[model samples]
Target: MVLETSSTAEASIRAPADEAAAERDLARRAQRGDPSAYAQLVRGNQGRILRHLLNLTGSRDEALELSQEVFLKAWEALPSWRPEARFHTWLYRIASNVAYDLLRRRQLVSFEPLPPDHDTPAETDSPEVRLHAKQTIGQLDAALARLPPEQREIVLLREVEGLSYEELAAALAIDEGTVKSRLARGRAALAQIYTRMQT
Candidate 1:
């Protein structure tokens, strides 16, 4: 039994130890000329990346195209990848930078459609829920657009990605205090907008 247990343990180790191990394995395999690992990585992140692009760029079509481009870029850069950071965090940083670069080049990003999220409510409650949700989201989008790009990025990093202050700092290449200060200021501005919405 002891020998059997040891063999199983060794087999599991040969498989993957954990997420970090898997990340390293996938990265190495991709680096050593495995296309499937890169495909798997792209599949794992496609949805999240597209949604984030949707929010950041405000265009579903562009988001889709950019997500593809992000994967292509990732494939090209995979050999350079060092697992010094969370893979998703690194991917997101790249996507964010890509979106920013595209925006900078075009001088604007097209706005996303603002149809309400009326799908998450009970049939009876959906009307009211959607009404309020639309108003709130509309106000948020307006205020978000009005904010400077850096401020909007911070706000979305906090609220949408749910990155911690330390994580946001690392992702944005800013300080933790700056993350906190930006969050506070951004929320305050959002509050003012919501209050005006109430009035």
Candidate 2:
């Protein structure tokens, strides 16, 4: 049993590296104009890209529309894509640009409350506790919508999407120092806004 558990742990740790390698191979094939390979790459990444866009745009309809545009732009640019960057990271760069453009054109930020979480607090939490949790999530979402798009994107990509500093820089076409400073400011602003909302 112990050996089985150890093996499972090791396999879990290796999964991301394995997935990245597979994606790189697919990207190379797509670069050579293989439609099937490109489809597979899109299938593997679309959900995450969609979710990321949804967070950035705060609109489901816009996110769905922008996700298709991101993939289309990726296909057009595939020939120039380098293997050194993770395929997903490159896709996100395209997505980031597309989203930023939309935000700039709209000149407004709006966020609905995040979808209700069905799995949290176990089944035993009191109604009051559950209500409080829901309210807190709503407040956080509102705070995010209030932030400038530039800072909001950094905060979402770092905290919500779990990107490392280097990945954030590559995805946003910014330097690591910029990513760090923006994320710091974004987080501080979010905290202040959330605090104000709670009072």
Error of 2 at 7 (Å): 3.0
lDDT string for model 1 (145-192, tens) is: 666666777787778877778667767777889889888888887678
Q: What lDDT does each candidate get? A: 0.74, 0.86
Error of 1 at 155 (Å): 1.7
lDDT of 1 at 113: 36
TM-score, model 1 to reference: 0.76
lDDT of 2 at 149: 77
Candidate 2 lDDT over 89-173, as tens digits, reads 9988899889888978987655554455512554588999977777777778788888887888889888877889998998988
- Which candidate leads in TM-score? 2
lDDT of 1 at 135: 70
- Model 2 scores a TM of 0.87
Instruction: Give per-model TM-scores.
Output: 0.76, 0.87
Model 2, residue 82: what's the lDDT?
98
